[model samples]
Target: MKILFVEDEATIAETTIPAFQKQGFPVDHVETVRDAEAALSVYDYDLILLDRVLPDGDGLDLLAALRRAKDATPVILMSSIRHSVAERISGLDRGADDYITKPFDRDELISRARSILRRPAAMSRRVIEIANVVMDIEARSLIVGGTAIRVARRELSLLEQLLGARGRIVPREAIERNCYGFDDEVSVNAIDVSLHRLRKALVDAGARIAIVTVRGIGYMVEETV
Candidate 1:
């Protein structure tokens, strides 16, 4: 998962950046609300980790702006100064999905972030649908016409990565990270082989979702029609 961390605390950013990166999460950091706004305007982050207090403006302001713009991407607010019940409630009211008090356990923070991401979006969806193909995320399976389809573990991971993308584009880098672990000896041809097999499997199973290769960049899944 990719994240945008809007924090001014040097210590917290320094510690969490590498911690998250170690788990295949790349984090982009911004210390001020203006920079946060700029980042939001350009990039799409899976989750936003925002600080309650910033060098330029209150975190609440940024939250309010996002909501006003109808940006419903999940946001987790962190703060040492405003972790009280009322403060947290206020943040939630302003559109923060989850709030974490400062000095939190990194594991706990990661868990909360993943939990939010796992839940079906009220505005979008967790289970992806294209043509007749359904990705049943809860069961970690795929189905077409109510029949289950078996996919290899790594290939299933690849499918989930593509289907879970809010945007259709799934970068080659992300596919490599999600498909193979550190101990696995993976090569450039690994993705091509996996895609070829997966494409054939889905076709044989009668799915109408077309996995389109974007030439040099990545892949996207779309309805065949």
Candidate 2:
């Protein structure tokens, strides 16, 4: 998804840009609120990561302006200073979707952003993240540790079923039904062959996830951690 990261702190912007880009999320960084306002006119973003403090004005002002213009872009507000419950409530009351205090975990920040984006009316995507690996169903590709790996169509379909189960055993019959229609002829070991190829591709791409067999049952996919 496209994201506008409006952060005035040089160090923070420098540190965050690459980290988000590494995960296949497109991030554009800007320092001042004036520049941020201009950017909003030029581009459309799935979300805005707005810092509370800005060089020219308060980030809240820009957020307020956006709301006044009837912009529906989701925003996650961030601040270096601690915010009291009332202050946080005030920010949300003003139109921000989520508030994040400084010195937060980068992963947690991304997780929160993803959670906000995953809301029904916000960002529409069918995606699953396990470790650093991101399965983009719409893209029909797997992003493993920031690198996009080309996947066969059939393999992509198979991976989705396993990942959606969240480590629970997904029956082979279920997988077959998903990968092939009812009329398609199936080999006795077709599923096994497809799983092997998918496994090999994940390894070659350095994904930190694995699909494991349940011996007497089906298969489960889990993060390598």
Candidate 3:
């Protein structure tokens, strides 16, 4: 999962980012609301971890604006002001999908993140579309411009990781974690080989989307002419 964490606290930022990364989620963070908006404008994220109070602005206002724009990305509000039922309701009413008190369980939070990522619309759906190419998740099928294309399971797994990142650049380690699990033998060449196959399959299918490799970084999938 690709996530944006909007918080100003240094200690919290340092601790949470690594913890979430350890759980296989790639995260980008900003200390102020303005930076958060800039991040949102430039990139797509699967989930947002927003703090209610910020140094520059209220996180609720950001949540409201995103909802007003019809952005349905899941948001989990974190706040110390979650003392009253009214406060809780206000946060939820403003558009947060979930809310957690300031002091939270890391394991529980990780589980919640996993659950949110595994939403029905994101998971159960057989096909995922990016530009003209559609990935049939269940059948391991790939269709581009109405033509069917075959792909290897590992290639499909890599595709799913890219899709799940919601267009953000996903790192090689994250690709390994999600695509292969803890038990599988992971190698740098493994990811490279699978991605090469995926790219070839998409090109062979006349796909309108291409996976762009960010050298010394990661990969992002985007529409192509």
Candidate 1 — number of clashing residue pairs? 0
What TM-score do all the candidates reach, one by one? 0.62, 0.58, 0.60
lDDT of 2 by residue, 72-169 (tens): 89999998874788878888999999999887788888888878877886534567787877886544567888988886666777887787677799
| Candidate 3, position 210, lDDT | 83
Error (Å) of candidate 1 at residue 143 is 15
Candidate 1, lDDT over the whole model: 0.79
Clashes of each: 0, 0, 0
Tens digits of per-residue lDDT for model 1 on 35-77? 9898788666678999988988898899999999999889999
In terms of lDDT, the poorest run of 10 residues in model 1 is 122-131
Quote the RMSD, in angstroms, for model 2.
Answer: 14.4
State which candidate, 1 or 2, has the greater lDDT: 2
* Candidate 3 clashing pairs, residues 3+ apart or interchain: none
- Compute the lDDT for candidate 2: 0.80
TM-score of decoy 3: 0.60
